[model samples]
Target chain A: MKKIQILGTGCPKCRKLTELAEKAADELGIAYELIKVTELDEIMRFGVMMTPGLAVDGEVKAAGRIPDVEEIKKMIA
Target chain B: MAECCGGGNRLVYACSGGADVGEIADRVARKLVKTGFARPSCLAGVGGHVPGFVASATGDVVNIVIDGCSVACALKTLEQVGADMTHFVLTDMGLKKGRTPVEDAVIDRIAETIRIKSSGRVEESPASTHDGCACGGC
Candidate 1:
């Protein structure tokens, strides 16, 4: 199963990112475990300074801003 | 340098761009540090997305951002990370972008102005929250 991680502090954008990531993973039919990292220390461990960061399998794909659903699909896939 | 007071720290970041006003902004930030009114932090690190630096920008600290002009590159950089900052523009403070001279006197004046204006209790940014990343754009 793919480990899909969303790094944020539960802000509006963070929630949006979470929703989009789940949608992308579902559409791709990927077996994924969604993890939300809300702690600053945990988020920083991924070396991301921006909000609504996305990570796939322990690797950060985007940070500081929200990526479109299409872009998120690419990352998860 | 002021005995590391208990009420959190005042972290200063300067634009330090290529222009003359940028130079002034850089010096002003340093002067604030030297006078013990604030501490110097890295704007470049935040801009470069260094995790530790970005983490440090948040929390119980006051972020003072200095910009060379209305361009506000430094402010934008911090904003990208959803940092809450008190911003200042040299041009808005009556310093000409290219014409301002980088002098200790000028730096001192600006630093004093900032120290005075930024004085008092720590002002919490309306955007700051326990969870952090309060930009609200998401």
Candidate 2:
């Protein structure tokens, strides 16, 4: 199962990223675990400074900006 | 160090290029560290996506980025890791990139400029983003 981690402090962008990431995963038909990391400390542990970061498994694929659903599908797939 | 004394960590990263201004930027960052204005951190680590290094740059800490020229490699690297930073460019301070002399006096002047600006509100770099790069022939 892919572990999809969203790192953010619960801003609008963060929510948008989460929604997009979920849509991408569903479209890809992949089994995944969605984790919301809202704490600053935990978000930093993922090596992400910008909010609304997306990580696949344990590797960070994107930070500081939200990638579109197609882009996110590529990240998890 | 007054700004960072009672606050979180202040990490300094310099562009240390192969030019004269690069040397000045490096020396200024070292001076900042020596004078306790900030702690020296690794730009290479952040570029390589090292988790610990990236984490250190986040949160309540202050990431001070000094670039030698308009290339802004140091600033770009930290930005990839989502670091919020105050940036400076030596060339923007009237120092020519290749023509400038790498003197302690010059380094001190630039360092003082950084110290003064950093002590108060953060100054964003004029060319802060990848879009600012004109290497695409645009």
Candidate 3:
């Protein structure tokens, strides 16, 4: 199972990123655990200075803006 | 003795979103500059992580961030770039998010709020010596 984490303080864009990430994961039919890292300290541990960061299996795949679903699917894959 | 933002100690960022409040934030920011209340700031530059903008936001000067409503786009962008800024939300100033008409009175009121932080010249102190002219250039 892949662990997908979205890092942010749950801002509007962060919530949007989570929604997109879930859509991508469900379509792939991949057994994945989705997590939202909202705590500032925890988010910083990933070395992501920007909110709306996407991480897969402990590795940061994207940061800052909301990536499109196609790009997110690729990241999860 | 290098100058940042044209040597101005006050910087203001407006929420340039696509809503009534957003437009109010933007107009208020421009009006502030026009009246010498603050220097202009780029919300996009801060959000995009531009080094120059980031430096100013986190610099010694005070950065005033204005948002149209509770969405707080300008404030968040500044936070992302590690900019410790003073913030003002228009809706909090009695302007309803969708109903407030954008006008000079509204813009001036918002600008006055930010201007208060720097000095007491809410409407600019009258000339020390009034020039006796009808042009009102005193």
Candidate 4:
């Protein structure tokens, strides 16, 4: 199963990003496990200073802003 | 030490998080740039690994990270990318992260601390040799 991680520091944008990611995943039938990376140390390991970031299988695909459902679907797809 | 600090290859980054101390950190960085203590630089670039920002941060210039609190956002951003840098945290400077006030006096003090820390370490320009090469290393 593919791993989808939302890297953030619990900021508002981070929360919104999570919702978007979950919505996208649900619609795509990706059969993926979604994890939210929240700790400062763990977030730092992803090297994202921005509030919200998206990672697929440990690879960062988008950061700093919320990508739309279609864009996120493409990223996870 | 020079009375006025200026004209160096220095890059500065500030966490600028939403907390009160984050405001202080951001202001201090801007003050350093306004006073010519260092060139204002971006944290996101280093975090994003943008080639230009990465190259600039790791170049021969001195790099400094000013973070709001122990969260060390600015410091970690540079450190994660392997960019050698010096850092200061507002909390370490005696300001509480959430309770600190973002005042002119506080900003000035932080900038001054940076100046004091930098005076002894500013790199001297390489001397030009008889062959007209200015490299510090022969």
What are the per-residue Cα lDDT tens digits for candidate 1 across B1-138?
111112224678999999999989999987876665665568888888765457556634578899999999999999988888899998998899888889888888888888778876453222222334522232
lDDT of 2 by residue, B1-138 (tens): 011012124568899999998888899999987775665667887888776467556634578899999999999998897889999988999999889989888988999899888874422222112211100011
**Residue range B22-119, candidate 4, lDDT tens digits:** 98888998888777566656898778886445645655556778999999988888988788888898899899877877899889998999877865
Please tell me what DockQ candidate 2 reaches: 0.11
Between 1 and 2, whose DockQ is larger? 1
Identify the CAPRI category of the predicted complex in candidate 1. incorrect
DockQ, candidate 1, comes to 0.13
Residue lDDT tens for model 1, A1-41: 99999887776767888999999999999899999988767
- What lDDT score goes with residue B136 in model 3? 9
Tell me the native contact fraction for each prediction.
0.18, 0.08, 0.00, 0.00
Which ranking of candidates, highest DockQ first? 1, 2, 4, 3
The lDDT of model 3 is 0.69
TM-score of chain B of each: 0.82, 0.81, 0.78, 0.83
Question: Which candidate number has the best TM-score?
Answer: 1
Q: Please tell me which predicted candidate would have the highest lDDT against the true structure.
A: 1
Which residue pairs in candidate 3 collide? none
Every candidate's lDDT: 0.74, 0.73, 0.69, 0.70
What is the CAPRI rating of model 4's predicted complex? incorrect
Considering TM-score, which of the candidate structures 1 and 2 is the better prediction for this target? Answer: 1
Candidate 4 residues lying further than 4 Å off, grouped into runs, are: A1-77, B1-6, B124-138
